[model samples]
Target: MGGRDVATASIWDAAHRRTTVGLLTLVTLVAFEAMAVGTAMPRAVAELDGVAWYAWTFSAFLVTSVVGMVVGGEVGDRRPPGPGVLAGVVVFAAGLVVAGLAQHMAVLVLGRAVQGLGAGVVIVLLYVVAGQAYDSRLRPSLFGAFAAGWVLPALLGPLAAGLLTTHVGWRAVFLGLVPLVAAGLVLLLTGAPGGTPPADAAPWRSRAGWALLAGAGIAALQYAAQRLDLAAAGIAVLGAAALAAGLRRLLPRGTVRARRGIPAVVASRGLLAGAFFGMDALLPFVLTEQHGWSAATAGLPLTAGAVGWVVAAQLQGRRPDVPRQRVLRLGALVLTVGVAATATVAVPALGGWPAYLTWGLAGVGMGLGMPSVGVLLLDQSPEAERGANSAALQISDATASAICVGLSGVLVAGAADAGGPLWPAVLAAVAVLTVPALLTARVAGRTVAPAADPSCATNLGR
Candidate 1:
């Protein structure tokens, strides 16, 4: 678990190379999809006449991701990370096609859910590959590279999505990704005998049980957001039970409770991601509603944030001995400032700039925080369990993101009925996140120093 086992993780270089190529492609797709849709969704909503359903479509992908991450972790632990990554890419791209071709809001939501499952599989395995194939020295660079890959989505996605929606149609947004995923599959599996490592995997019953729990729970949450009726409540309860069973199967013991060390780290990833991404999902809406800004204008500020992340990641990767927890705390503080800045929206002079500032700043924080977490989580993993443990960390992100986004949906809907002030919704979202950010900062502060035992970096968030 310590020195020798950690060192052995570096032996899988060819595997790592293959995985990086495949995952970079996957991340590119995710980044593009998220960014493009953000810009396009407003137009899509107008056409679809279903503004109420917007949040659920995004949340559905995320909630199902939780289960996918858990299952991915379990399976990644049991087998090579390659095949899992391939399968995920295919599933994700296929869902994109479905979404592009959809005729109704219901079908679009279904597509998002399917896409979410694939996202989980791709993300966990990508992280698993990093944790298992890279050592302490190499891991940071890989994480940085991963972040860099994501920047493409954050940068070009909005512009492309907006343009595609404007010219071709919103459906073209989904249509564009099919070839990329297919090409990636070919590149990743080429020269291999059986293709990516087949997931001989655990029993079907176990897999089905977890899937049922996650799929149903997310659907329930979607319904709950739409209506707070007794039916929704009952469905949510059942879904919660299913999720519990799934988590029990997928995560390490005590992860649900956030027991110390690695489990704590993993849990923090979920909450941290939730606190950040959940609020972010609504920013485009805020801009368009509050400032009457077009999607393209609203998305440009993200360029600055993306650049900042790329710069920070490069710096972090170069400094191999930097304590990861400090990096995480630094990111949290920057992000908290970013989140809290939305209060400035009350000023008309500032216009939507506050929203853009906050959104862009959060991107920088994420860039700094995300890769550091990936590196640390892998550092904590033992060799045999590297893939599994790495997957767990990512699952934490997906699960928490889903829940947080779903909760945000409920809050936004509630706010919509009562004047629909953007700042109030922002405040509601930021308020819940502060608790986790503080906790994350504290834990990050403590664990970071042990990564290198530096005196100065020891109390970064303390």
Candidate 2:
């Protein structure tokens, strides 16, 4: 019999089954770790006496991930994806061990930084693998599967982490995941296909210097945000300069300006991530510090949001005929509304309990937008440049998230120093940050590239 048409084939079909299962397993593990950390962080920082440095834990991971993203993209373009993924899993497991054993906030931060490095590599390589292994028509289903992987973790990770942190100590949250990573490694090794690099892969040149510079710039900016002195101004300026210099080399030309096509797609990812995650990183803190909720209680709203996200993502996947730009625009508008409503929780009289509902709305927005961006990106990218473009997308997210989270941290730190509530200040910072989402919505039209499968050489400058 003639071979079945790949376009209409299910991701679970025999030819694709192992890789799909392995990819979903890995994604679920990553999502579980992310949810667990968010739920456990408040207690973890309190015991380590790092409440004032709270944002650093997040920023440190994001900054170092930028470096890893650049390197991973380069490696994926030049070699087989399997070995790079294996290396990343090993490093990630080591970081988990270090974090679980931490006796101080500094050590925990160090461990988080290492985890970021490995995660960045693993995620980017996975995208390259997806691009290589599946037909374009099958990608929406694959991305949907990836989002579904987050669903179980979103539902249970918070509750599990909270129970562990309360009953067994927060250390269990990190250490417990090591075995899962090992299992994912086994699946990946068995399933990942061997393939030759693209014949037109760009010549390898070292991007490490630029990546490190960008990472350092973000770290310096985060540190400066925590200070309330004149030197902070100087440091912020220097950091901005260094970050600009570094990003110019790493991202597509005109990405900073939201130029048309792939650049616009990359820009949208940054804006959406910055607005959502910036607030997400601070939400648990807002509840515990401002509302006096228990760690477990604070995590519930996050779980609600994840539910909304997964639902919307699955919906989007089922209807691949919808224009991605339209979905992107709608998601941004919805998120803007959700953020505005959630801000009311900061007002002392509002009771703050409605965040459970409002934040889920925000999650729905992200669900619609994020996967749309991913699908659009791959559809636009030529085979040889898929790895690099994927890196650019991730770097945009990490850089913007670090900046947004850092800025919010500054406001919260200032409020705490003055013996005031943190929620009001965070409310204001989040309101201002929503501007980017609004801009993204307005420019969503530009994310479509002019050519069918435009390569980096022809597409970026437009």
Task: Choose the strongest candidate by TM-score.
Answer: 2
Q: Could you estimate the TM-score for every candidate?
A: 0.77, 0.86
lDDT of 1: 0.69
The RMSD of every model to the true structure, in order and in angstroms, is 5.7, 4.3
Across residues 405-436, which tens digit of lDDT does each residue of candidate 2 receive? 88877777788789976776877877877788
lDDT of 2: 0.83
Query: What is candidate 1's lDDT per residue for 1-462, written digit by digit as tens?
Result: 477655544323564566557656767777678667767767766777877888778777766776667667666667676777778887888789888887777788888888878877877776766554456777777788888887867777777787888999888888888898777666555522232333444343335356546656666666676676668778777767766676666566766556655776676687678877676655655666667889767655556567767877777777667678778888777777766665565355778676656667776777777787887777776655665666667656766776777787677666766775766775676677656666666666544324444564457647
Q: Which residue runs does candidate 1 get wrong by more than 4 Å? A: 1-19, 34-64, 93-114, 165-172, 189-208, 228-245, 287-296, 299-304, 347-352, 355-358, 420-425, 445-462
- Candidate 2 accuracy as TM-score: 0.86
Clashes of 2: 0
Ten contiguous residues with the weakest lDDT in model 1: 191-200
Q: How far off is residue 137 in model 1, in Å?
A: 1.1
Among all candidates shown, the one with the greatest lDDT: 2
